[model samples]
Target: MNATAVTVFHRPPDAESFEAWLDWMGETAFAAEGFVECCRAVSDDPALEPGFSVTFRSEALVNEFLDSAARSRVLAEGEALGIQRKSSDLVIVEGELPPPGVGVFHHSVADGKAADFVAAEAELVTLSATFPGFEGVALFCRGDTGRWFSVLRFRTAQHLSDWMRSEQRAAALPALRAELTEDFSVVAHTTPFGSTLRTVDGRTRVTPTWKIAMLVLLVLYPTVMTLSRFLGPVLDENGAPPWLAMWLSQIVSVALMSYILSPAVAACFRRWLDPVDGAGWRISALGAAIVVVLYALTLLLFATVKWLHYWDYNR
Candidate 1:
């Protein structure tokens, strides 16, 4: 991959139509050459307005997509919907394209803490580079809200997880936290796995980090167990190397998590995940009941099938 190209658009008043246009554009870009990923965000403060951003692998590809008929149609639709194009800039990112695990962190800083926060953030950036799989970090402060945003790229999800769980990061958190007016927000874009959650209006609503972690654990545990207990032996019988077998198993696990398990879990927990005022306890209870039922059914299904024993595999 080459450099990343970013384009920003001013949100339209017709949120539904704008979102539909976004959906179409994203889908079309996926089919285009050198398309990496795209995401949109609506500013919490209405004065900042709402917009979307896209990252492409190269400038040539970006131009090709921009000059294409599909993009023209999308633009026409946006114009018809009264959407305004604010500004578009293409950045030729220097150095190698970072790995799959990319994420953005948005922080609302307290008054008078902007300079101090930037200084502390600079130190953290240096420290983060020393950790494994740290690709690079970019920091930007919005003039409107004085909010600080950091974009981080890591080699893989495991690498990102390792950094998140590191004691160094924990130790660095308090200094950063003291500068924040509210809880910091983070959104990941790990290729197929870290896709953004969007509302019907095309605004990005990042799922709370804890909820995402919990959902991953729920899907990951069974995936690993089943793959190891069953698929491991089959791969071994076919004379595949241990390392390759393990890699293949992981590939399957990620695929299932990305395509099947994550979506289902998100749908089932949607009410609790995005709760309305009075629906909290009811949604919680219902989510818990559904989880219990699913777990019970999974246990029952696995228990009846004796093709492979869960604990029989050698490490």
Candidate 2:
């Protein structure tokens, strides 16, 4: 696609209204003269809002659509939903975007210097593709704001990181900058998986804290129960004080949760935990229900294995 029209909408207090507007605007956008494909994503940070990016194979056709009188007519309906069209420069968008990883670079190439800029970018793209896990890259000219968007995709975060931090890229920077009016900005797609949450250029958002709390409890409860049944007695019989036994058992619980179970459970239900994954009411309900069922099953196991119950021991 030669051009991409990127528009971010303000998220309403409720998802319903915003979604309805999305549906309507979505149809209107598709009906545009030069529609190629539309890609939509939410920011890692909830405070930033979500947006739709439509790509057109031909810039001239898209430009015609943008300037059409019909463009204002379609947007008038969104006014009721408090949607306002404000012009903001697409200067730099640095944040985690999703699954593998995609780094987006916005370059302000000076007028009449497109050829030189593309040569510089093409060299970087060719070099980047040789790196392990390199997938592909796309270059788009955002005629609306005279910005060039270079998107590079990799098969994994590690691959993207290697290319970004490689000495080769560092050395190539001066020549790349030589062709641009201003320094380019870049960042990629990501949502932290589980407790492995980390920020990339100040853009990683951890899965909701409460959700993480829930996953911890899921792993922690059974850990404590099992430890109390087995380890507690061994310590107690060995003349350890009651307080000391309890404290030791707690240490094992923390260790397992920190190094093992938390990451495990987080991996299992990562979709629900991630806000960017668009886990709606149904996914949330399903996840909670599954956890509750697991809780019941664990309780049943403890209830059935009577001899293992600490309270009933020696009875």
Candidate 3:
């Protein structure tokens, strides 16, 4: 099942009491088996509803929690604590985020004008409402870094383009540009995807070439081992069990050689060829090459080991 997270925004009557209640709810909800994490943060203004974000692994789990008696009891306790339900909207989406890439854009502004940054980011944040399929904005400022990062998430490619092309937003850009110094105007994109796959951020790691190689190996490996097993019985050979020993030998050799040489070999090829520019092609080629090398190395290692076994037994 795909991972899912639900966010509920509600305005509470009492600010202090509402925050305390949210904290309690957060702790209580996390005790559930499917709960991955949750956060309760005040909205930008008291007028805006306070926000509660709950993360879970599956929709089924979320539904189970909502339908259970636990939810009823929790609602009762929350009501006693003065927490009331506000308007809620649910967004369901599934897609992988590109590697840890951050896009940066900057504009110059007048000196000693710091307040303009607020108006600037406010405009950017509004793109979610202004443009189609805009998800949200994460804006950050670092005095030490002397730079601002505004990360925008969108549900579709068209949504991203809408903000980029809006003439009204373009007109407002000058005011934003007026707030930065000479070196402030800049943009950068960085990709970070490796190891663990995340629901919001992680995408499929499998490539087409890798898929093909795996299919070939799946058939070839088992067939060869099965044939070897039958041949051993027909030849009346005795000692090690052919199928089990060969299968174990193949798996071990492949893993060992792959760990030792795959990355280095792939890097060498990348440097030498330098033909692939797109991420998809580069990744696909690397994956295919790695699988082929792994399979070939497995055969070499397993054959060497088997020959050694035969010679040792004969001696």
Winner by TM-score: 3
Candidate 2 residue-wise lDDT, 51-170, digit = tens: 556666665665665666666675676676676543321222223343345566678988788777777777777777678987555566655455776656677777887777788888
Residue 69 miss distance in model 2 (angstroms): 65
Better of 1 and 3 by lDDT: 1
Name the regions of candidate 1 deviating beyond 4 angstroms.
Answer: 1-99, 188-271, 274-315
Candidate 2, residue 211: how far the Cα is off, in Å: 1.4
Scanning candidate 2 in windows of ten residues, the lowest lDDT window is 86-95
Candidate 1, residue 232: Cα displacement in angstroms equals 49
Pairs of residues clashing in candidate 1: none
Give the per-residue lDDT of model 3 (tens digit) for 204-305. Answer: 222224343353463456345544444434433545566665665566545533453333343343322222222366665676576677678766765766
User: Who is ahead in TM-score, 1 or 2?
Assistant: 2
lDDT of each: 0.64, 0.64, 0.48
Q: After superposition, how far is residue 177 of candidate 3 from its true place, in Å?
A: 16
In terms of lDDT, which candidate is stronger, 2 or 3?
Answer: 2
The TM-score, computed over Cα atoms with residue i paired to residue i, of candidate 1 is: 0.37
